[model samples]
Structures are given as structure tokens and as C-alpha cells.
Target: METPASTATAETPRPVDRADRIRSIDVIRGVALLGILMMNIPYFGLPEGILGSLKFDHPGDANYLTHQVIEILFSGKMRALFSMLFGAGVILLTTRKEHSAGLSIADIYYRRILWMVLFGVIDAYVLLWTGDILYAYGLCGLFLFPFRKLAPRYLLLASLVCFGMLIFKGHLRFQDMRGKREAYLKVVALEKQKKKLTDKQKDDKKAWETVVKNGKPDQKKINDEIKNVRSGYPTVWAYYLPINTKIQSSVMYEVYFWDVIGMMFLGMALYKLGVFTGRLRRRGYLAMLLIGYGIGIPLGWWVHQETTLAHGDFGRYLDSHFLPPNRMTYDIRRVTMALGHVGLIMIIYKSGWLRWLTGALAAVGQMAFSNYVMQTLICTFIFFGYGLGNFGRLTYYQLFYVVAGVWAFQLVFSSLWLRFFYFGPLEWAWRSLTYWKRQPFRISQPDSETVVSSIQA
Candidate 1:
């Protein structure tokens, strides 16, 4: 028998070998990584302030059609899917470590998340992508390490609670908007009658004015933003820093933290149920596809249409009672759409008829971290002032061309890169940081090029 110390040394945990990766999960992750760009490109290529305006394009325009298709099919769906995958990843990492009887799980866990936090900062400040999700995910992941072992039911219950909180918060916002609109109307009536306004009423009128100003696109504001985005690197950094800080701080907690943690909990529960592992039957997946799409598509369409109509008038958009489905069904539609995607991807994976497509996607998924960062680099280069300076120039529909080009490049590059290497450049770096040692970066085996092919098989 070996000594305990020797046994510990022999059993040191390492990154999962490529052969052990679940192909379906990788494929789904790749789909999400690629699909997210469809939504993110608007932020990368347009004035941020105008993003909230529903009337970005007139009816029958290319932009309007593109917006409709994306909103109905892929709005929040990709983020939800990505969040679930991250949650599943937590289970995958901890379970493997536990089975191997390696070092303390918390030690490795926190170290990994902390490093991710650092990366998120770099992605935001250095890479100049303010919409980075890693920082928020890292923050939420801190609270997730302890709950890994919870039963699926309890984990789901926790997820539902988080989602419920989000819904309640959305309702409160709607009510607040209603209150502000009411106050503004009251103040307007008093002013028309030449009566004195109360202090509260004056404040409310001011608040409503602020809302309308922000919601309606001001050409001067848009011009200023475009000019700022087209300036040199230092100016660009200064312009975006506070915005990045706010997103990473308050907006992160108030908006994204709950969304991420809830999906994470749900993902963890699904993993425990073996859903991510392709253990769910074909009929079950079919049912998910049908029910999820059936519910999500209609709801999303209705919400989008209402939003389009309401946003045509800034005042109408701010009137809470104008649209019933706006924020109320947000979670329901996104979650269901994501479920539909999961089922659809699972069916394709199990069917094995789309090996060519799935094979490429799996390769992309395998290196998702590197690819995600790569996108930020590429988009910034194309649109930021220091690079191509195309910011605020592309029409809304034209943004997809950039997205498509990036998708093609990443699919091919990631597939080819992985044939000779065990990990993507960033993934290797991240693993090295997490394990406190440099990992083997290249594949030594003669058959390494066939790794993705095996998944296709």
C-alpha cells in the first residue's frame, strides 16, 4: 500500500482531456456563443443610447425585419442557454475533482472564479467591451460553490425563487413608471390651470421628462457618442470607463446577478438530472421542443409587437399600462425559448444526421472562452475609433455581416487550432491559473486531429 502523501501526489487533478467532453453540450454551447453575437453586434456597432428605442427602423425596412426575427427567436435565449451551461460546468468541475479525491474543492473553485473576475475586468477595460458577462458571472459564481450538492428539486426551487424576485422587481418598475406618468399628468393639469405645484409633483414631472429624454433618440446625443467612440484610445477609454464601471457594479447586481444565478441553479438541477449529458429520451426532448417553442414564440412575438407600437411614442412607452406583456412575460418567454433551443439541439445531436455541422460547432464550443474573447477583440477592431472607426456607421441589418464573418472564422479556426493543441490559448491560460501550474498545451498523440471527429461519430 502507498503512503497517503504519495497517493495524494499521484492523484493530483488535471483538466479534463478532450476525449471526455460531452459532444452535445459542446455543440449547444457553441451555438449559444455564436448566436449571442446576433444580439451583441448592435451594442458594438451602434450608439448605446439608441438601443432602447423601438423605432430604430421604419416598417418594411431591412432593419425592422431583422429586428423582428431576432427578437422573436433569439433575444434572451442565448444568454439563458449560456448561463445554464456555466452552471452545468460547475457540477462537471466539482464532481470530477471529488471523484479524483484531489485538493479542496473550494480552494480550486474560488481560485478559478477570482481569475475569471480578473479576466472580466481586462475584457471590459482593456478589450473595451462594456457588455462583458464574465465579471457578473464570476460574482454570482461565488455564491454557487456551496450549493453544488443540493438535490435537483431544491436547486430548482432556488432558481424559481430568483426568477420570482426578478418578476416582482419588473412589476415594481412598471408601477413606478405608472406613478411617474401619473404625477407628470397631474403637474401638467395644474400648470394649465395656473395653479401651484407641490414639491413631490414637480419632482415627478422632472423624472418623467428625464425618462422621455433618455428613451427618445436625440440626434445631438447620438452625434456626440459617435464622435467619442471614434476618438483615440485614451479618449475612448475615458469615455467608456464610467459606463463600464456602472455596468460591472450596480447594473450587474441589480439586473444580471439574479438572472445569471437563477439560470445557474436551473442548469445545476438539469445536470443533476442528466439532461445535459443526453440522458433524457428522444420523446422527452421532442416534447420540450414543442411545448417550449409553442409557448415562447407567440409570447415573444406579442411582446415585441407591443413594444414596437409603444416605443413609437416615447410617452406611450413610459405609460406602464400600455403593454401588458413587456416585462411581465420576459422571463417566461426567454426561459421557454432557451428550453426549445436545448431540445432542438439535443434532437440534432442524437439524430447524428448533422455531423458536419455539429462537428464544427463542438470544436467551437470546446474553445468557447477563447472564442468569446476573440469576438470582443475582433468587433472592437472593426468598430472602435482606434481600429476601423466604423462605429455608428453600419445600418442595423448590416451588423450581421460582421457577425457572420466572425462566426465562420471562429468555427474553422477553433476546429483547426484544436487538432494540434489540447486547449485554446485562453483556455490553457485559464486552466494554468486555476491549477497553479502550466498545463500541457499541445497534443502529443498522433491521432489528436481526430478528436472532434470522434465526437461526430
Candidate 2:
């Protein structure tokens, strides 16, 4: 009879070969990172909600076209791709360690997540970008470790369940909004008729009024917000700091947690299915592109048009509500577009037609953490009062010029930095802190061969 350890060894699947880094994953990650910057640039250069409010009054205007294109192509898709990649990274790290060391790496992984959370807090609070996703990513990562061993089918099913829950919650919220609007209208009617309102009715009317004011802010209020953000650093910081705290707590944990975790689970399932490893057939990839784009692009375009026609009014009613269609179909559009992107990137990688560009992208992916932070630093310097103080100045189309410049810089800098160093600056620090051992930084001549092979693999 075999010993229990031997029996368990036979039963469990062997660890995957992680010695050779997957070049395709890195390339796709790089693409996702670049796409994310495209979406973030608007937020960086303009006041919050300005892009959403900018009316495309004329169809021929460049700004209107730019807004439409960004909404259709980039909005949630890049973030979804990034979240999925994070899930794939979790499996890759934990399984590789288990395979090589013959033991669980839970303790070290937890430490890594803790550090990531710390970094996220710093990024959000210190750097002052209220739109930071790192904090949410860090928090969600803590919940992912236990599910590492789940089967791919179960993982996908769980993801769908999570998504369903989000959709259900959204429906409930929409209904609640409708009820409030009806109640508020009744109160207005009573006031017009010179009838008295009960104390409870008065309170309900006040609450609904506040909601309406916030959802559809007046033009003067929008201009004031723009002026405030365009003012000095102290003024802008004071205005946004409290808002950031609320967003970091409620929005991050409440509204976005489901979306992030659902994509992560999908990512893990895809990874297990060999989708990210270039193992899927060309026909399968082609099908993903066809079905994904066929459904996602047109639906996204419809939402964009609907939202634009509403002039960005965010009311409760379907006809009057700003971007209601977009809100309703957000997950479906983003996920399908993300799948389409993955299929496109995989095809490009397999063809070996753009090795130079892919290689550069892989470098950027390798140092994603560093590049992400660097983007915040650079953009804040450009737009914030302490730096160039150009906030609320650039138009939607002009923002793309800044994005293109940053992309060029990051591509060149990442490729150059990796040529000499073993890891990106932040990645090195993160690894050292997690492992409690200082990792090697400078690449020795002998190590150069390994680094090149890893990059090219």
C-alpha cells in the first residue's frame, strides 16, 4: 500500500512549467495597459464628469467623435482585461511555487497582497488620483487565494453567478430610483395644489430633490467644479480628498468588487483552459473575435448614441436617464470586447508578424506596476496645480496627444530599463518585501542570457 503523501501526489495534477515565461501573456498585458491609459487620460486632463457631460451637439466635431470612439473601444474593456490578467498571475505564482518547493505558498502570497494593499492606499491617498483601481484589486486579491484550486468549469459558473448578482442589484437600484421619482412627483403635485405635506412626505421630497440635483447638476455648478479643479493644488486637494475617501470605501468595495472578482474568475478559467497559452485553435480564436465584436461593438455603439442623445441626463426614467443603456449592458459589452481583444492579441502573437512591437509590449507588461504608478505621477504633474496646472483645459481630442506621448515614452523606457535591470524598480521592491529577501537588481553578464530567453519565450 502507498503512503498517504505518495497517494496524494499521484492524485493531484502536477504543477505547470513556469520556468519559461509566457510571452503572449505579457504582450496582451502590455496592450491592456496602453488601452487603460487611453481611458484614464480624459480624467487626468479634465474635471470629473466633464467628459460625460460634454454634449456632442454637432456630429462632425472632432471632440464628439473622440468621445464616441473612447466610449465604444476603451472604457471598461481595458480594466476588465487587467483584472483577468491579475487572476491569471495568481494561479501562475502559487502553482509555480508549489511545484518547485513542494509546499503551499499561502503565507507569502498573503504578504504580497498585504503589501499591494499598502501600495494601493499610497497611490490613492498620496498620489491623489481618486480613480485608482489598485486598492480594489488588492482587496479582491485577498479573497482569491482560497479558490485557486477550483476546477475551471466551477470557476466560470461562480463568475457568472457573481455577475448575475450584480445585475440583480442594479435592477433593484433602478426600481428604487423609479419609486423615489414617483414619490417626489406626487409631493410636487401636492405643493402645486396648495395641499399640506406630512412630515414624512416632506423628508422624502428633500431626499429625492438632493438626488436629482446631484445626478443632473446645473451648468453653473459644472463650471464651478471645473474652476475649482483648475485652481491651485491646495484648493483641488481639499475638494477631492474627502470625495476620494468615500469612493475608496463605498464605490470600490460595494459597486466595483463584484465586477473585478467576476473578471478574475473568468480569467482563471480561461487560463486553465489553455486560452492564454496559445493552445486554442486558430478557428476558436477567430470565432471569439467574430462573436465578441459582433455582439459587443454594436451594443456599445447603441449605448453611446443613446447616452449622447440624453445630453448626459442621469434621471431614473429610461427615456430621460443618462447612459441607462450603458449602465444596463456594461458587463456584457466590456467582457465581450475584452475577449475580442484577447483573441486579436493571441492571433498577432502566434503569427510572429510584429515581434518588435510585441517584445516592447512584453517589457511594459513585465514592469506594469512601475509603469502604472509612473503614469499617475506624470499625469498629475501635467494636470495638477503643483505642476503644469493645465487641468480642465484640454479638449477630449487633444488629450489623445498626451496619451500617445506617454505611450511612446513608456514603451521606450520599459524596454531600456529591462535591458539592464532584473526587474522594474517597484517590482524588485515588492518581491523583496514579500520574500523577506533582497532580490538581485542589476543583471550580471551570465544572467543576461536567461533574461533574454525569458523575454523572447
Candidate 3:
């Protein structure tokens, strides 16, 4: 009979072999992480509602134009790219350890995801960022386990089906918005004629009025919100905690779950097809870039124009909001653009034209968990009342200055830190928790070769 010590040793999970780490995946993940900051900085520095409304207090200015460009290009694409990479990562982790000595891959993966969820809670609530994705990713990851074994084509099909469901849901929302707008207009017409409203009509009118008020916020409310954010950390947390809770618990599932899951499925398909391995023909990547940009850029530009044209007319704006033209094509546009980015990056990586740049990005990707949390910490300190007290003070264009500084710091910091340590501090901790054992932190001379060759490979 085996001793208890021997039995416990047999059940310990093996670590992921670093030699098999794919550099291109890291490069893409690095790019996605950086791109995410471009979209997130607006929320960090300004009101969240600014992105949705066509009319801004600073309309037609450089800041306004900059916001438009970010919306058109980066808003959803980076997150989609990140989700896809995560899907690919699921397969990588599971299969790589399938035959290793340990618990079943599924058991280990579930534990990993559970830990991720815990981290996400800290990120979302304690960190006070409503846009946190880690929790959502962790929840959706549980759904990806069974789908991991599906063939590439089937996985791609399932992804498309998921997006189809979102589009269908969008259509329903559009219809509901149209109905509300019609009811609001009818109530307006009755009031103009000095007619009395029924009790139900009175309630409907009140609700619609509230919606319109929120959609086109008055200056006082905006200023008050800014004041609250700039008051101090305790005030900021008190204000945002409930809002973040609602977002994380409900809105995220209702609006974003399908989008993320679909992207993950598509990502897994792409990985299985060898797209991330740099095995695609040059022509294939060229076609992806051309076709993706050809459709996405023009459509995005048209949406921007329509949104601008609809400003200042509440009814028309409400109509535009209800039937956003982009709803029909949002997934196509974002997915294509994300693919275009992938193609562009892969070409750069394969050509070896900018090893230094790619190498730095890969390092950032390797330490993505640490860098992601660090970004939240740094941005919250800079903009929230607790630190710099600069919330809502900067223009959209000015916020990019902060973004650039953070990017530079992370890139340089990630590169230098990796030189001495095998894993990032957070990565090391996450690994230790996942495996229930401490992982090596310092890079020995032989381990340094492993890191170098992994990058060169």
C-alpha cells in the first residue's frame, strides 16, 4: 500500500512547460493589452456616458475627433482580440497538461478559473473599475471547457451562432426603444393639446422623460458627478461601488457574455487552424488585412457620420439610438479589424524587422496579469480624488498623454523585470496558487537560455 505522502505527491499538478510557449501568442496578447488601454483611458479620465452620446460639450474639437477615432477603431476590437487569445489559451493549457502527472485537466482548469474569479472580484470591487473583464472571462471560461474538443470548423460555426444571438437580441432592443419613443411622442402630443394623461400614460411619460434627461445630461449633473469623483478615494468608492456591483452582476452578463464567448470560440478555431503559429501563406494574411479594413473602416466612418448628424434632436437621437446601423454589422466590423491587426502583427514578427519592439511587447504579454492590475492602480491614482484629483479635468486628446506614459512605463518595466525573474510577480503568485506549490522566481543561467530560445523560437 502507498503511504499518504506518496499518494499526495502523485496528485500534484505539473507546471506548464515554458519551452513550448508561443512567442506570437504573447505578441498578440501584448498588443491587445496595450490597445485596451487606448479605449479604457476615456472612462478613467472622463464620464462613461461621453462615449455613447453624439453631442459632447466639446464637440468638433480635436478631443472630440480623437474620441470618435478611438470609438471607430479600437472600442470593441481589442477586447475581442483578447477574448480570442483567451480561448486559445484554454486549449493550450488543457492539452499541454493532459498527459502530465496530476489531477485531470478539467479539475485543474476549474480550480484555475475559480481563482481567477476571486482575483476578478478584487479587481472589480476593491479596485473600483466597472470595466473589469477578468471576472467575466472567468465566468465564461467555465463554458469553454466542453467546447475545447470541438473541431476548428465546428467551433467557428458555434462562434458565429453566438454572435447571431447577440444580433437578434439587439434587434429586439431596437424594437423596444422604438416603441418607447412612439409612446413618449404620443404623450408629448397629448400634453401639447392640453389633454390629461391616464395613470399608465403618466408613468410612461415619467420614465421616458428620465431616459431623455440621462441621455442628454445637463451641465450641473455633469459637474456634480465630476466633483464627486474628484472629492477623494472614499467618496469615489462610495459612489462607484453600487454601480460597479450592478454592472458586474447583471449588465455584463446581459450585454457582453455572448460577445466574449463567441470571440473565444473563434480564437480557438484560429489557433487550431495554425493562424497564430505563423503558418498561414502571405497571401492569406494580405487578404485578411485588405478585406477586413475594406469593410470595417468604411462602415465605422458611416456610423460616426450618422451619430453626429443625429445630435441635438432628442426624438431623432432616440430613433438613432434605437436603430443603430452599426448593430447589424458590429461583430463583422470588429472581428475583421481584429483579424487585420493579427495579420499585421504576424507579418512583422515573421519578417524579424523589429525584434526589439516585438520582444518588448512579448515581455508585457508574459506579465499581462501583473500589468493589467497595475494599469488600474496607476490610472485610479492619477485620475481619482484620492491621488492626483484630476478626474474629468482632461480632454479626450489629453488623456492619451497619460496612456502613452503608462505604456512606456509598462513596456520598459516588463522588459527589465523579466531579465531578472522567470515570471512576473503576479504570474508567480497565480501559478503558486493554481498548483498549490511555490514556483521558482529567479532566472538561473540555464533558465535564461530557456527564456531566450523561447523568444527566438
Best-performing candidate as measured by TM-score: 1
Worst 10 residues of 1 by lDDT: 448-457
Please give the distance, in angstroms, between residue 272's alpha carbon in candidate 2 and its true position after superposition. 0.3
CA RMSD, predictions in order: 2.5, 5.1, 3.4
Order of quality (TM-score): 1, 3, 2
Cα lDDT over the full model 1: 0.85
- Highest-lDDT candidate: 1
| lDDT digits (tens) for residues 1-457 of candidate 1 | 8998877655665557556788788999999999989889999999966765533447767888889899989988998999999999999888763223555778788889999999999999999998899998899999999999999999999999999888888878777877788889989999999999889888988999998777777989899989999988998899999999999988887789889999999999998998878999998889889999999999888888788877777567666464356677888898889989999999988987778888889988989999999999999999999999999888788899999999999988887887777788999999888877787788777384466553342
Candidate 2 lDDT over 1-457, as tens digits, reads 8998976655443322224678788888889888899888888888656665553656768888887888887788999999999999889888763321332488778888999989988887788787888888888999999999999999999899878878877877766777777788889999999999999889879888887677553677668777776677788788778978998888876678898899999999999998888999888888888888898899989988877665544442443663246567988999899999888888888888788888889889888999999999999899987788888788888989999999999988888787677678998898878766576687666366655653543
In model 3, which regions exceed 4 Å deviation? 1-18, 49-59, 98-100, 191-196, 317-322, 446-457
Residue-level lDDT for 254 in candidate 1: 78
Each model's TM-score, in the order given?
A: 0.94, 0.88, 0.91
